[model samples]
Target: MTDGGAMLPWLVIRQDDNGNRYRVGSYATQDEAQRIADSLGGRGPERLYWVERMGQAAPS
Candidate 1:
């Protein structure tokens, strides 16, 4: 859970050349998530990485 009651709202998403998307990871802060995506970007030219903020949802 985070400051505004969102549980791991920051998401790191990856997409490959084949048009398949995957949830690489989740984070409490956007910066942390972006850093991870940036690091992964250099690994493959055909793979795309980005960060997104998911809707706020309370933890179970």
Candidate 2:
């Protein structure tokens, strides 16, 4: 989302259930696993961020 600064098609995400801390990383694409994070975001998660590095379909 940074206009192709470091990489492209990254996964912007966070961890925990209380909307605490988070991180970002580049992903191949919007894989199905993204649904988990999407669900969390709908629950009032806070401090959301976007990634710009390589990442896997796992927890941040």
Candidate 3:
């Protein structure tokens, strides 16, 4: 469970040719995660996603 003041964890994910999503790294902010994901240009398809904390609703 996360308190109102807590910052959620963000993950930088990349998809392999087999379409399996793998975590590149965890970050404290979405911007940080995005920067890392963007830095992997031409490496593969990637995106930033929020890691759902306990008691938090999943993103629709």
Candidate 4:
């Protein structure tokens, strides 16, 4: 987690070959997660949020 809520953990949502959500992933850095989320590039139209992993350890 980051102070001032500037940068925090995040889950990079992705789908499997069959088009199903896979396991929820947590990242130490938000930048890394953002990259994964960016790869998704929005499917047609969907709501998304860039959030931190609750009760998860912050970047060391």
Q: In each prediction, how many residue pairs overlap at the backbone (N, C-alpha, C within less than 3 A)?
A: 0, 2, 0, 2
In candidate 3, where is summed lDDT lowest over 10 consecutive residues?
47-56
Q: Rate the local accuracy (lDDT) of all candidates.
A: 0.82, 0.49, 0.56, 0.55
For lDDT, candidate 1 versus 2, the one ahead is 1
lDDT of 1 by residue, 1-60 (tens): 355675798988888889888889889889999999999998876988888888643222
**Candidate 4 — which pairs collide?**
1-58, 9-52
TM-score of 4: 0.38
**Ranking of candidates on lDDT, top first:** 1, 3, 4, 2
| Number of the candidate with higher lDDT, 3 or 4 | 3
Clashing residue pairs found in predicted model 1: none
Model 4 Cα lDDT, one tens digit per residue, 2-52: 546665456665444455554346666778877766765565444343434
Residue 60, model 2: Cα distance from true site in angstroms: 17
How far out, in Å, is residue 42 in model 1? Answer: 0.9
Better of 1 and 3 by lDDT: 1
Tens digits of per-residue lDDT, candidate 3, 1-60, equal 123666547666565656565666666776776777677746634543344322445444
Structure candidate 3, residue pairs in collision? none
lDDT (Cα, 0-100) at 22 in candidate 1? 84
- RMSD, model 4, all Cα superposed? 9.3
Q: For model 2, how does the per-residue alpha-carbon lDDT over 1-60 read when each residue is reduced to its tens digit?
A: 444574345565665557564554445455532644455465543444433334445345
Query: Which of candidates 1 and 4 is the stronger one according to TM-score?
Result: 1
Prediction 1 TM-score vs. true: 0.77
